[model samples]
Target chain A: MSAQIVAFGLLGGLVLYSAWRVATAPLITHAALFLALTLVGVAGFFFMLQAEFLAVVQILVYVGAVMTVIIFAIMLSTPALIRSGERPTLIQQILSPRYGAIPLLVGVAVTLLLLLAYGTVSWDQVPLTFHPSSQFPGGSTAQGTTGLIGEALLTRYIVPFEVVSLLLLAAMVGAIVLAVEGSRGKEDEARD
Target chain B: MTDVPVEAYLVVAVLLFGLGLFTALRRTNAIMILMGIELMLNAVNLNLVAFSRYLPAGLVDGQVFAVFVITLAAAEAAIGLGIVLMLARKRQSVDVSDFTELKG
Candidate 1:
């Protein structure tokens, strides 16, 4: 009945709808755009959860950077493969036992299993507000969530942070190498 | 102060994960599969942030981990898209069904 629940319901509906479209849209470009909408909805959830920093990052990274990369790849890749071969109606796509049955069953089974496993456990006992002092001893809630996260990254989680930087560097280099190699191969073929 | 139960968030995350799994398995396009993976990762991030908000013990750890997960997702997206572009250039197709052979 509260405003939070109402907001959550709206945002959650948007996310689920967009996610469904992302899964089933006939055009790859449409799916990519739906994926952006889904990410934006998730960012709204982050805002509702009081993780303001993460909400910004979700929008910036997922919707901004990742979606851009995906759209770019879609444009660069094959035009022929972007559209589904048979444009079945949404109802038909769902009703057709052959194409949708297995994946649908698997997805439903996984979701049900997860829900059954976690749903029974009581989550109400958990505290609703974060208390930084409990974890950090001298830490105060006055410190912003973003500031605390930064401190933790530099102090407690420094090793993983550094390692992730290295991993990202490697991935960037590898992507560039693959892209360059692919173009060179095309040039070689043209020459021959 | 929010009365929204953690179960609500869990339900959303679970459904999102299922949708992502369905997309990944059902879609033949490699880029679509990668998008599905991104969706799955986003679901996990949502869980982490939800826990951080409601659980005292989680504190900022969940948020930090979410940041790391986002970073990893970005890296994965870059690498995955790069490979897809390369394959598309080579084969003139991005459909996974077209990629029957391991050795090209």
Candidate 2:
């Protein structure tokens, strides 16, 4: 086995294990932390895929920003709810012979169906090497991906880029409004 | 140097998506469900990056699209967490099963 395959096996195992924990960990806080680990593993995959820019963004955005938001949400929640909400062990739930098995079954079914679909296509024609035309932006080097992506964002993808910025602005405003309203409601209840 | 096959990456992405689906369906906590959604998004991003690396003529489009997807995921997380916080405040619980006001 090549070192690349071994590395991939290790990273993939870490990702799958952490993802399973995120699904089954009894404590909400533990699950959130596990989710961060899963994201980090995915970032490792991005690095192995030669998308260095994306790897950095994955760590920065998902592991850093998104995980922080999730942890904060978990912290702000009622302690009683967080403590007592999800208490069943994964094995117990799977073996309970009730609706507990449904999620697992559904997940397995979806994965099998997707694999079946993937098998229908012949991917042998796809090249395993990363070779972009010399005319392509960034010239196909590992370091060029970031520059290429930046150029694309400004040139061919300008419209979508601008729209996403607008969407982010809207989402930010909406979140602040919702959060402020929630706290204001609490204050009103206090006054009453 | 032996390169990893794109199929290997696809398999990992598929497994990740399945696990995300399971988490979203199995968890009653709204934040956990959101986490599951994030996992699914990450899986999709993996697929995009893998294709970008191996596919001829793919150039940088896949990476650009992945960036957009990541941006969208961030926005979705912010909005989803905000809504969940509001629900928790009003209902005193984050359990999805408890919010049944619309069952009529």
Candidate 3:
């Protein structure tokens, strides 16, 4: 009935479509693209949840950085063009058989039951507190979430914030070790 | 839905987890399985972020944890892919089923 419902319905549909694509797309590259769309939808949901900063970070970090890395990895690994006439998987193959429709029907039924059960549950009683909205004083609305987040990171959450940088450093070291192992093996093979 | 319920996030997470699970099971490629592992890790990150948003108190901690998780995911991909590359160089295959030898 309300505009909010319409928006949610649309987002939900988009989420489902992208998720399905993420699962069913045969090519690894298309699956990654679908993952990017799903990430975008998730960022939109974060905005709706009033986490604008998180939404931006999701788009920046996941879409911009991580997905780029994944795409590069895929490109580095796979052949220039996928060989035609290659079979997808047994799951897809099963879809054409006589018993294929049974699993599909069961899945639909389970989804419907879960939806019905969820509708019967009461969720309004959960305790929730929102940060002082940006619309208020302190020029919060004008400056937006980044300033507040930065302030909090420095003042209130300084220790844990720095700890994350260290974690990333460790990850970088680990990645280097793993990547170099491959090169060492290549040199060995050259000798062989 | 008026207010997006916490259950909504959890349900989406469960679905994502399932996709990761299926991918891990069905994909014969070792690199693809690593990608599936990354998906599972992202699903867990989404769950953490969702709880942080809904609960209101554990904001920065959740964000910090998510950052760590993302870093770990990247490291995992690098290491896992490196191993695959080396395996392909040595064993000349990326199929998981081919990895039967215990040692050099």
CAPRI grade of model 1: medium
Point out where model 2 deviates above 4 Å: A81-86, A96-99, A126-143, B56-58
Query: Stretches of candidate 1 above 4 Å error?
Result: A81-86, A95-99, A124-143
Each candidate's clash count: 0, 0, 0
Clashing pairs in 2: none
| RMSD of candidates 1 onward, in order | 3.4, 2.7, 4.9
- Candidate 3 lDDT, A10-35, residue by residue in tens: 76667657766665567777777887
Q: How well is each residue in A1-192 modelled by candidate 2, as lDDT tens digits?
A: 888889999999999999999888888888998999999999999877777789999999999999999988888875765566646666788876533588899999999999999999888764566553453334454555787788889999999999999999999999999999999999999999
Candidate 1 local accuracy as lDDT? Answer: 0.87
TM-score versus the correct structure, for each prediction: 0.90, 0.92, 0.75
Candidate whose TM-score is highest: 2
Candidate achieving higher DockQ, 2 or 3? 2
Q: TM-score for candidate 1, please give it.
A: 0.90
Provide all candidates' interface root-mean-square deviations. 2.6, 2.1, 4.8
lDDT of 3 at B80: 70
Which is superior by lDDT, 2 or 3? 2
